[model samples]
Target: MRGGSGHSGRLLGEFRRTPLLVPLSEGDDGGLMTGWQGGVRWIYAFTDEGALARFAQSRGAGAGTGAREWEYLSILGARLVDAVIPTVDGPTGVAVDVADEDASMLFPPVVGIVADAYAVDAGADRADAV
Candidate 1:
């Protein structure tokens, strides 16, 4: 949860993407995705990975990531607007942000992590993200 940090504003602006800890296998290079109730074909990302980790913990049992390695992706918010199809039976919580001209809920693809082998320079530590 990049909880309204001083730097978060810049993050929210340049990087419209949020962080979600998917099990490394959920999304592919093409940005196509699956899962998340009713097969929404949507990519479920969070404001930050902490939010996602908390969510996973709340789910309990198999939902908890445990020691399993997960990968985070920063998807293109514009692509999401194009791919998200609306239907009466689909999941909720997503809408256009009238103020920003973006998905009300947005996330940036993960270019790097705190302890990654590769240097991504997301500009802040994961702890600072919260």
Candidate 2:
């Protein structure tokens, strides 16, 4: 997966479309924001690494304050893998092979993962303080 050092704004935008797993902490760069999603904490590092490092240090005194939110995404990635297992049989209950096996398996898992991620993110935010 891509590192979270320079895509904070894009990450924030992505998270905003879905519920965040944690409260969003904005950095001075204005483009970056850290938040949680799907029982995972993330560092939306939009700017360069230097900027994000400063932001993490700024938030003083917390057990998991400096954690990156992308860690949670990694967990979701595994779940996504599970959700994409191929189906042996077709809709007609006939034995058949499909060319785009991976894509077919991915569809439901992708949807479920997104939904679950949103729910978990919202729930985590409500339970904890950013």
Candidate 3:
């Protein structure tokens, strides 16, 4: 959701309330596995175990020598957007159910989806005016 629309607001609300499974990278820190696209970094969140499984499989996790279960962190969408996204460097956002094309949702780093300080487009108007 790009933000600033009723439908996008509702979708963001629902996403905030949902429980998401976020994959963790293997290491001491076990940080979140992020993706970069459209000049924005994305934190992936799955609706359920099945969704996560699909994503892992697509990444070749269970194929050939790469077969292994993914480690994950269970978190609410709100915490991801409100707390986590802010800590990341540069522009970041949440990607929900990404493996499922029809069910996917993207909460981009815009005014409403992120804090004003972190939003890439937050000061766009002022910049243009300058």
Q: lDDT winner among the candidates?
A: 3
Q: How much does candidate 3 score in TM-score?
A: 0.86
Q: Please rank every candidate by TM-score, starting with the best.
A: 3, 1, 2
Ten consecutive residues with minimal summed lDDT in candidate 2?
Answer: 88-97
Identify the runs in model 2 with alpha carbons over 4 angstroms from their true place: 1-46, 60-130
Residue-level error in angstroms, candidate 3, position 102: 1.0
In angstroms, the error of model 1 at 51 is 1.0
- Mind giving the per-residue lDDT tens digits that candidate 2 earns over 1-130? 0242455445434333432121233455342133443433333322233333343455542237565542212112323223312221111110011112221111121222345433224345444443
Better of 2 and 3 by lDDT: 3
User: Would you give me the overall lDDT of model 3?
Assistant: 0.86
Off by over 4 Å in 3: 1-6, 27-29, 63-66, 126-130
Which parts of model 1 have CA positions greater than 4 angstroms off?
Answer: 1-23, 26-33, 36-39, 61-66, 83-130
Worst window of 10 by summed lDDT in candidate 3: 1-10
Compose the digit string of candidate 3's lDDT tens values, residues 1-130: 4334457667878888988999997678779988999999999899999999989988877756747778899999989988998899999999888888877778889987889999998977775544
Q: For model 1, what is the error of residue 90's alpha carbon versus the real structure, in angstroms, after optimal superposition?
A: 11
Select the stronger candidate by lDDT from 1 and 3. 3
How much lDDT does each candidate structure score?
0.38, 0.29, 0.86
Checking candidate 3 for backbone clashes, the offending pairs are none
